[model samples]
Target chain A: MKTVSPFLELESGPRVKVILDDVALSLPQGANLAAALLAAGVPVFRDTPISGAPRGPFCMMGACFDCLIEIEGTTRQACMIEVTDGLEITRIHHDEALA
Target chain B: MTRSDLAIIGAGPAGMAAAAQAAELGLCVTVLDEQPRAGGQIYRDVDRVAPLRGDILGAEYTYGATLTASLKHSAITHLAGAIVWAIEDQFRISYTRDGRGAQLDADHVLLATGALERPMPLPGWTLPGVMTAGAGQILLKQSGVLARDAVLVGSGPLLYLIAAQMVRAGTPPKAMIETQTRSDFISAAQHMGGALRGWRYLAKGLKMLASITRAGVPRYTSATDIAVQGTDKAEAVSFISNGHTQRITCDTVFLHHGVVPNVQAARSLGIAHTWDAAQQCFVPKRDEWGQSDKEGVFIAGDSAGIGGAKAAEYAGTLAALQIAFAAERLTREDRDRCAAKLRAKLAHEQAARPFLDAAYPPYAQALLPDDSTVICRCEEITAGDIRGYAKLGCIGPNQTKAFGRAGMGPCQGRYCGLSVTALLADARGQTPDETGYYRIRPPLKPVTLSELAGMEVTTPDAVH
Candidate 1:
């Protein structure tokens, strides 16, 4: 089936490249960073402490901030912020805020 | 240092009408709309490519377009693509333009900021193909693209309209799976009786539904999300009914629970808010005049509540009249008559809301998406992490910050705020509104860091 989605990886190429936790990886060009990471087999975005229910990006727009990742040492909107080559994203942890 | 006697925050029905009213009363006004053009969501541009030939936009939108156009000749200053970032008690607003920050001070502030798509999270909702109904409509109407061969899911009056639009655009959805049930609609109809106060509105809903039926959109009521399946993209959907599983293969899925006020600026302003249980959202309490508790702050449009564009226009006109009367430009009798007419229209609009609300009950899906469901997709946090942080006795969002770092990652809590609030609300047995969404500060859209750096930064005036 032919599909066209604004958030999909059409051609297999390094659409955008970003550094996750300082590790470099190339994502499908123009794909959402979260979706790209998921496609790349990076399952977790952040962790919860109590019941341990895993949550990810639900609303892809900036409306549902479940997809907050630190980029260039500042928290940025992952969906709104397009992926750029060498962009650095640091995963936030449940206990990280205490720091 | 742009200046106006009254500054309206949006150019939708509310803001445009209010600006026209105020200008007619001899006050200088400025209307700021974020869209490259005017017309809020309801009167959104239909297919920027096909560009609804002025005649095709129907009377309301075309009339609104004319009204907005007429304001251009008034003393009203219209700023397109200007996103107001913050409001001060003295009626000054900070905003960004052409990658620079500027400030505008007005004697009176009217926030017609409008509404936002309500976030409804479910399993596989993070998939690439899933999107809000509004997003799909925007893509179709503005981009001339359709989410065809798509699964239209959710419970709202908008869903059918979306399907109708898609059909009208020559690409209807593969199926319409509604989370609302017939029994739920029975109550919705009983609620509609209250709305029957006016014949026009009753006819409107009928016309919309008739259009939907004519479109031949297949519908499934009492439906709920079971799962969205795909490896990297959504290739299929599996929903359940009466403990039975059903599956459909579709590349597109549109979801919307409802809409909530885009209250970031309002919350940042620290206005007292009351929970409208029927509406299931926190809205600023306003007088019959649309004035917030703040003396000079007025709210109109969906920012006040969701009563569609007509109500917004009426509210906007009344708000402007209030300001006009307050400024002593209008006689007492004129003000009273306008207010009376507006009040009656408001009462009629308010009547239809209960029916709409009952028709769309927020479906409670098992949100805790296993231990692997990513909670903070940006930070890569899992549901496990959120629960772990909550176990540390993080009672509220602020407290959770210290324990699990839930709301601190970025997007400044816009993306994860709703789900986190829903999770915490469920945990505490509180309603979703009690958990409260995040604070909306201005530059509603993302502003480049340079914009903030260049801001005059007037000592970061107290939010209040």
Candidate 2:
């Protein structure tokens, strides 16, 4: 997959490593987790339970809840969560019942 | 428990201005916002993003820097990362910050939640890679990322603004599919005199359109029946333009129509709202000073109506002045003298709204999507399901919600409320107002039960 980083990354920002579905990836420490994942070519953040359809962040400003995932055993909006080192995130499975 | 003379929800232009003014008037102010920064959506991450991104975000965005800085220096208690979930009677607010529940009581509360992009529910809108234009702009603003090979769809000034912003960032979209027709321009022309009073806005719009054209993005005007085509991701967009079928392959599709007041907090608080025919959305009823029907509550900024940032700032100032007068901190004469200039500026700022509303009405076809198109992305409900409920004598959105669970998702009808109302109205052959909207209840945003249980309750008088 090709990376689609649209803007130039500032050199001085803090860099951190986080685990995405057991894959370790480094991103800017304070960047939006969803944007970081998308820049790293991780589309299809979660699948709709009813239709098993793929959905990603839509409104990005917390209005749309499409970019939901399991983070530290709790479902959180990926767009709303900031990237932090050692953060553990798991892609929400379509068949997994929402809490 | 905490107490204040005024509690302002949201840290946008309106809330920031209101808090600053109220604090200067000898009132204790507390401002709560969900975002990690003070600037609301319009100026999200301005304190951090502006210096690094600079010209890419443009001057209008950098203006938020001064507002955020002033807010930081003010006497107001600013709570970033605070999610206000409930506001009880007697001005009690329950919110969570840093995963701990807290409560605050205020003599008055100001709602400045601001606006959201009008729901555009065309076929395949729920697919991955299909997103609102505002979402794309947020990505650029917050994380310095943009969708690659994106095709812009729908109509309104925001469409052009995002397109121009992308061009400035050196990642111009593949093309634009506009839904407004020649008649819309003609309708807007009648309001030219009033619009000219806000000449700066008109000039800004012209400059953005010129930038889009100069970028050489292919534009299809009067586009209708627009739909994104994909199996699991957005692959292409199909539409009818100029009496001909058109299809464009793209990696991403961004849609926009206009914006409507984020009335969730207001509606949950039982604030009276009336439909604004020009803007074609429900707005909270407020007086000149931003007082709602519910005493001790105020609605300001675009949340009261769809005025832009400048109008929101002026409205915030006016509302604070009124709160000051109510607190007996200023004489009536002094309040009037302070509000005179703000009132004049607000009038000029809002003069162009009617023209903009007429020029970029939500695409009618987009509102009433085809039967197979999904209306509620959260519940996976389709247009056909809503229409079926309507045909079965569903009286309004609330009834439809009961029957089909269309608005009972995690998004809490924020994404589907307007479309559901319009679809029901079209089916019932009644006006949207007559069809009515979802009866919003609180816990306006999701809250953990643990957080709620942790809240400390205090008597109103005891806190004061």
Candidate 3:
């Protein structure tokens, strides 16, 4: 599946390489990290502990916790965090890390 | 510890307006927000994103640029990337910024935290690709990225606005499955005169609809029994339209059903709230000047109710003017004169809300997901689980929380508060209000113990 929509690439900005789950991808600096990851075709930010059902960013605002991911050893809302060069992001599988 | 005459909770239109007006009136103002930038969700990243993306965000968004510029130029201290965890008695605020805990005392506090999209829980809504329409717009606004192979579900002006934005970006949704029934239009017709009084809003909606229509995006109206079907991720969306089952293949499914005021902060402060049946949500009770039942506290903007950005600004200005008068910075006549124009503008801005609210009433049935559907995403609680608790004599959301940890998640009842209330109400055969909402507690947002321990404390008399 093509993750990055072609429309967004129409105008380029400063690019920064961030490692997501050890896979490095170049995204526009200061762009929302969750959006950058989603555009990069990396879905399923976390899995439900009970059902292990995949979940990703829902409401990009802080209202919904669906976008929670592990960044810098702390789980944070990916949609709320801005992308920076060399930032390491890891997918969280359970809610325990968030607690 | 920091002290200011005025402390504003958000940096949206309301917060910015209050800060600007208060600062201009010679009050020491401090504004704290969770976002990295001052612009709240409505104008999220307006300073940086608007300049880069140009008019792709539409005209309403451009207005935010002026507000943000003013905020930047104001003497008020603005703290971005700060999460206010608690607002205690004596006008004390506890917040964490840059991994450090801090406390502040203010003579007056303004909550302009704003609104959240109404939770539209449906079958398969928990699927990975399904997200709120507002989220998709945020992606565009913050990063200039549009979801590919998307299908929009539910109904509201926001749904149309987002779809139109996508169309303008040359990445229109594959289809729009609107759940608005014929009755909504009938109810909306009754308020047409009031809506006409605010012709600009009606015109904007009409233009957005026309643009979406012109884009030739396939639209399915009166869509019912909508389901986002998927295994590992969203593969297709199925809905009944015109009494016929229709399915569309899409990776992204954006759902919207209007918005509700985010009353958590006010509720935590124990402010009075009244259920506005028109908007079908709990709104913090406030006076004309945005003063809540709690003295020295004000609820402005969508956090008070869903009056949009313009109304928020007017209300913020009114609140600041009132505060200024209270501080003896302005005489009675001066305060009244300043507020008079704002009051009129606010009335004009809110004139169309009733029509919009009636037209886009959250399809209540859709809100009550089937037994198998997940209601609380955090604890993985299903609708059936909540109903089971209700059957076991859970009378309200508070009791239901004890039976099952529904709202006790990282999001703190934000995702599931409404659903739990509605489900309990249905089970008890009572209105949602009778079932009651969860009692919000402080440490509103999660805070680490280390951060809390690091907080500076001062005696009450020291600040004075």
Q: Pick the candidate with the highest DockQ.
A: 2
Model 2 lDDT per residue over B209-291, tens place:
99989999899999998989999788899999999999999878899999899999999989888878888889988898999
Per candidate, native contacts kept equal: 0.10, 0.66, 0.65
Please tell me which predicted candidate would have the highest lDDT against the true structure. 2
- Give lDDT tens digits, candidate 1, residues B1-464: 66678999888889988998899989889887765567666665422322343332245445656555656755888887676777885778878765578788888888898887765556676665666787666544333345547888877767866776666555668877778777777877877677677566667667767766787876777776557788656778788765567888987788876877766666767777776777766789788888998888899989888887788988999999989888888988999987898888778877777877887776656343455555554455556666666666656666665665665654455545656765676667777656665554544555668788887755444676
Interface RMSD (Å), each candidate? 7.0, 2.3, 2.1
List of clashing residue pairs for candidate 3: none
Judging by TM-score against the true structure, name the best candidate: 2
The full ranking of all candidates by lDDT, starting with the best, is: 2, 3, 1
| Structure candidate 2, residue pairs in collision | none
Model 2 whole-model lDDT (C-alpha atoms): 0.88
Better of 1 and 3 by DockQ: 3
Instruction: Tell me the chain A TM-score of model 1.
Output: 0.71
TM-score of each: 0.78, 0.96, 0.96
